[model samples]
Target: MQEAVIGLSHLFMTVFLCCFANFMVIPAITDVTMAALCPGKDKCSLAIYITGVQQAIIGLGSLVMPLVGKLSDTYGRKFMLTLPITFSIFPLVILAYSRTKWYFYAYYVLKTLIAMVTEGSVQFLALAYVADNVEESRRGSVFGIMSGFASSSFVFGNVSTRFLSTSATFQVAAAKSVIALLYMMVFLPESVVKYRTESTETDCLLEKPPTKTWKLFKTLPSVNDIICLLRTSPTFSKAAVVAFFSNMADVGLHASLMYYLKAQFHFNKDQFADLMIIVGIAGSISQITLTPILTPLIGDEKMLSTGLFFSCAHMIILSVAWAPWVPYAAAMISIVATFAQPCLRSIASKQTGPSEQGKAQGCITGICSFANIVSHLAFSPLTALFLSDNAPFRI
Candidate 1:
C-alpha cells in the first residue's frame, strides 16, 4: 500500500497545473502580452525580444538549481519542493489582472524567479520519494506510471484552455494548483530516512563530530570522476544527450510552430488549441504506450537514442512546413520523444547513488533547462532568418 501511494504521490493534479498554465498562456500571449512586453513596431520582432528575456530568466533558473540542490541537502526537501508551486501564484495573479507593458515586465521577472525553484526541489523531491520507497527493479515501472498520469493532464488542459474564456481558463488552473497543494499537505508521505549514514565508519564519525554543511557539497565526486563516469557510463551520457536534443527540438517547435500554423492555415484560438491537443495526445501516448513496449526491446540506451532520432526528424519535417499531414507528423515524433523520457530518467537513476537522487535529477534537468535556453536564444533568429515573410519562404 505504501509503495502504491508512493508511486501515485508524485502525480498530483497540480503538476499538470504547473505546466498547463504556461502552455495555455504563452502561445496565446506570444502575440498579445508578449507584444506588450516588447512594444515595438514589429510584432514578430517584439516576440523575439520577449523570448530572449524569458530564456534569460530560464537560464537564471538553471544557474540557481545547484543552490537549490544544496538547500535540499541541508534544509530538507519538502519545503523546497512546495516553494515553487506557491510561487506560481504570482504569475497566475498577474495574468488574471495585468493589462500593460509594465505589468508584463513585473510578471515575467517574478515568474522567472519562481520557475527556477521547480527544477531543484519541486521536481526532485517527488522523485526522491520514489527513490526512498520503491525497490530497485520496480523503479522504472513506477516512473512510467507516474509519467503517464502527469502527461494526461496536458491533453485535458490544452483542450480546456481552447474552449474556456481567458480569465476562466487561468482561474481553473489556479484552482487545480491549490487543490494539488492541499493534497500534498494532507496525503503525500515523505519516505526519505533523515540523518542516514552509508556505513559504520560514518556512524562512528558522527559520534565523534558532526560534518560541516559545506562538506556535503564538497564531498560530491570530483570533476574527474564525473568525466570518468560519463565516459565509461554510456547510459548517463546517452540519457543526458537524448534529453538535451529532444528538448532542443521541442523548444524550436514551441518557438515557431504555432505561428507557422497560424500563417499557413489561418488557425484561430479553437484550431490552435486543437493542434496543441494533438501534440499532447501524441506526447501522452508516447509516455503511456510506446516507451513500455520499446524500452524492453531496445533497452534504455537505444531507447533514448531512438527517441532523440524521431524527435529531431519531426523537427526537420516541421521546419520544412509542407502541407497535408505536417501537424500530425510532428505530433507523432513528439509522442515517441515523450515515451522515451521516463526511460532516460530511469536509466539515469540507475547510474547514480540513491542518496544523491535529488542532486542527480537536478543536474540532468539543469542541463535540459540550459539546452532550452540555448535553443530559445537560437530559434528566434533561425525562424526569423528561415521562416519570416521577407525570407524566400514567403507564402
Candidate 2:
C-alpha cells in the first residue's frame, strides 16, 4: 500500500506537468490564431474554420486511441505514455521559436497531427494506471484526486499565461512539456507487471504460444471488440451513452465558447485566462475536496447524474449570457459539473477487470473522440456563421 501511494504520487506529478504544459498555451493560441489570420479583427471566419478543420482531423485520427490503449495493455503504460508526451513537445517548440504567419501555419499543421494521439490518450492511460494500482473500493476517490491535480495545473497554467507575454507562454510551455516527459521516464514506475503476471498464469495453464513481436499490430482491437465490450454489461453501455453526449456538449462549448467571447464581449488573452482560472479553481476545489467526500456517500451513479445536471445548467447559462459577468457566474457551476468526469470514469472502470483497464478506458475515450468530430462538424460552421459579419440573422 505504501509503495502504491508513492507510485501514485509520481503519476500525479507527471500528469500535472503534462497538463500544465498543454493548458498554459490556450489563451495565447487564440490570440495568435486571430492575429495571424484576421490581423486586428475579433470575428474571423477563417480562424474559426481552420480551427474546426484541425479539430475534425484530430478526431478522425483519435479513432486509433483505443488501439493505443490496447497496446499499452501489451507494452508498458510508461512506454505508451512516453510517445504522446514526446510528440506534444514538438508542436509547442514550433510556436515558441516563432509566431509568424507562416510559422503559425506550420505550427497548426503539426499540432493537429500530434494532438490526434496526445489529446485524450494521456488522461486515459493515467486513469488506467490508477486503476492498476488502486483497488475498486477506493478508485472513485483516487480518480477525483487525479483530476484535482489536473485542475490545479489548469489554474496554475492560466495564471502563468495571464502574466507572461505570448512568446514566453509558449516557450515556458515547451520547456514544461520536455520536463514532463523526462519526469515520467525517470520517476514514474510501470504498472504493466501486474497485468503481465495475470497473462502469464493464463498462458501457462492453456499451453499458449508466445505472441510474436511482429504480430502485435494484428492484435489491435476491432469494431467487434468494442461492440462486445460495450455489451459486457448494461451499465457500461449506459456509461458509453453518457460519455458520448457529455463529451459532445463539452466539445461544442470548447469549439465555440472562446470565439463567442471574443466576438460578443471583446475578450482578449487576459480575459480568457481570467475566465479559465475561475473554472479551474472551482474544478480543482470540487474534485479535491467535494468529490472524495460525496462519492462514497452518494455513489458514482448519483454523482454522475448530479454533475451532468449542473453541466447542462452551465451551458444553458452560457448560451444566454447577457453580460460578461454572466459567463464568470456560469463558470462557477463547474464546481459541481466537474464531478461528472471522475465519477463517470470510476463507474466505467468498475465494469472491467484488471487486465482490460486500458481497453475499456481507450474505448470510452474513442467514443469521446467521436463526439469531438461530431461537435466540430455540427457547431463549427454554425459558430463561424453566427459570429461572422455575414450572419443571416443576428440576435
Q: Which structure among the candidates has the greatest TM-score?
A: 2
* Candidate lDDT (C-alpha), each: 0.61, 0.88
Tens digits of per-residue lDDT, candidate 1, 1-395, equal 34564456544444554555555664355444534754443335556656656765676577555455435544455655667767666676776675477777787777777776564345555565565566655556556655665667767777887788766666666676666676666665544534344442112111212233556555443445445546655667777786677777677677766655655665555666676678778777776566656666667767666776776787777777678467765676677766566767787777655455555566577667888788888887766565455676564
Regions of model 1 farther than 4 Å from truth: 1-7, 10-14, 20-23, 34-43, 73-75, 117-121, 193-234, 293-298, 387-389, 392-395
TM-score of 1: 0.82
Instruction: Kindly report which residue stretches of model 2 are placed more than 4 angstroms away from their true locations once superposed.
Output: 1-6, 192-214
RMSD of each: 4.6, 3.0
**TM of each candidate vs. truth:** 0.82, 0.94
